[model samples]
Target: MTSNDATRQALIVRGGWDGHQPVETTDSMIPFLERNGFAVRVEESTAIYADADYLATVDLILQVNTMSTIEKDEFAGLQAAVLNGTGMAGWHGGIADSYRNNADYLHMIGGQFAHHAGKDPAERTGEQSDNYIPYTVHISELGKTHPITQGIDDFDLVTEQYWVLSDEYNDVLATTTQSVRPWDAWNRPVTAPAIWTRQWGKGRIFVSAPGHRLEIIENPNVRTIIERGLLWAAR
Candidate 1:
């Protein structure tokens, strides 16, 4: 587990749907990664996904691209790199909504963005509305002692608590209850993962679905989680 700063390499791939402010969010995280001793690389295209030579040298990847197309080989190369022991860490759509059509990518990442209550058809399309309800994120019992969620108490935020499509493989660390309301009604309330971790081959995968905006990255608890998650996922 002893890693030298000089040898640890990280790649930041940024560029996709601008609404998510992919580059800005990625920029918000770079200084933190650099301070943690990783030699970080920033790229604007998924084309970097196909560079096997470069992928082979990376220890961790910070993907900030959202809703983008990834070519077959490019996707395969990323999967292979992680399977070979590289780590993958990211937040929100950048990680969960990256490739809509790639199932392998979804399986490896362990979840996908199904919808946020605010984005439901019934709710009017406006960023600031009742649709954006204030909710609290509770750390699961399993997360109480986990390094990522340690010392973090239940916190409330006025943002989209993403309802995700997940699996049994994830070690869910935090979750929130989805309340059924007229504007965004569900048959019943369902608890969904707010943060989680999983593995693929030798790779470590970490995801936090809270930082949809750059401000969310500034949340002390959220920032701490991502910082710790990045280190934990690193090879």
Candidate 2:
């Protein structure tokens, strides 16, 4: 790619826990990426991350792998690429919960998925949906003006609301509050970041906590946030 080039390259490395539907979710984003002038490459393994030469030419990386382990050299390659200005972006468990054993990866992302608050036991149905609840994603004052979230009003959805363990390095855009009930462990309501961005070295990392499945990803607001995030994070 040249300075005057109009097209940029995107690398999509997906595949991990099948529950997150990594393939389908990432597949849906391909056409959108192409339409935005990105030459997309989809790889199923982390092997491509170790290919420094190839990574050098990539302007953006959309990682959809969840709860997977990344090899040391492969992780190093990824870290180096970002440090040198490759943008990284992903959503839900894919970006926030991937590579549990690697603290370095977490350090780069600036947040981790702790758990999804479940409904009261009396209302639980012994299904995954037990964790799904109606919640509102509140836009922060900063978010109201940020390019990714501007003009997007706070929205409500019934889904798995994530409780993320995050640090101050992240620029929080939107948040969801987990209310305290008799059945819950926490004392008071806890507000967790639902959308955030981190500046790592020369790269920008964008994360959205709402996309647990295709339906959630396709939500008009969620889709717009992600689309804008991809372009915002690109090198």
Candidate 3:
């Protein structure tokens, strides 16, 4: 199709840590994108990021990769694509915790996953569930007016609540606080961005720090925000 085609193109690059259920999570959104007029493309690797010619044709990129590495050239191509107006969106560790060693990627994302503070030591079972905790996502006043989160009331969730290191460049839409517990090292409670967006060059980037699993992605509020975010960020 030509660049002027009415059908927008979305590229989904998913696959990394199975703990995040990347495949299932990204697959769940395929129908949503299709129904909204996106011609979707799914790939299991970041190798496609190196294909500048193809990336140029993409209107949006939905990445669900976690803790994986991207080669220098691959990242360069992806960076160039976004700089030229291709939107990028993703959630949780897939976008926040990816490419631990790549500072340039983190800079582009405007945030990085510091860690997920686990539950009370008493509840620890040496399993992934140990990181699950009850928390609230507080929407910012600006978020109330933003298209992606408007009308969405604050909500609670029992899951991996992320503690993120973000920059001033991000427009934080929602945040979650990590409280000070007797077993915790931090002296006081700290709030971190749970949902945010950034404008880079001619492109837009959106991130919601929720979707760790399919069920979480399917949450009505989370789903709505993500769907709107995808559309909002699309070129």
Best by TM-score: 3
With a 3 Å backbone cut-off (N, CA, C), the pairs that clash in candidate 1 are none
Question: What is the C-alpha lDDT profile of model 2 across 1-235, one tens digit per residue?
Answer: 1123338999999999998899999999988888888888899999999999999999999999999999999999999999999999999999999999899999999989998988889989898799889999999999999999999999998999999999988999999999988888899999999999999999999999999989999999999999999999999
What clash count goes with each model?
A: 0, 0, 0
Better of 1 and 2 by TM-score: 2
CA lDDT scores, all candidates in order: 0.87, 0.93, 0.93
Clashes of 2: 0
List, residue by residue over 2-111, the lDDT tens digit for candidate 1. 23565689999988888778888888877777778888889999899899989999999999889998999999899999999999999988999999989999999998
Off by over 4 Å in 3: 1-6
lDDT of 3 by residue, 1-235 (tens): 1123349899999999999999999988888888788888999999999999999999999999999999998899999999999999999999998898789999999999988989789889999899988999999998999999999999999899999999999999999999989999899999999999999989999999999899899999999999999999999
Worst 10 residues of 3 by lDDT: 1-10
Give the TM-score of each candidate. Answer: 0.93, 0.96, 0.97
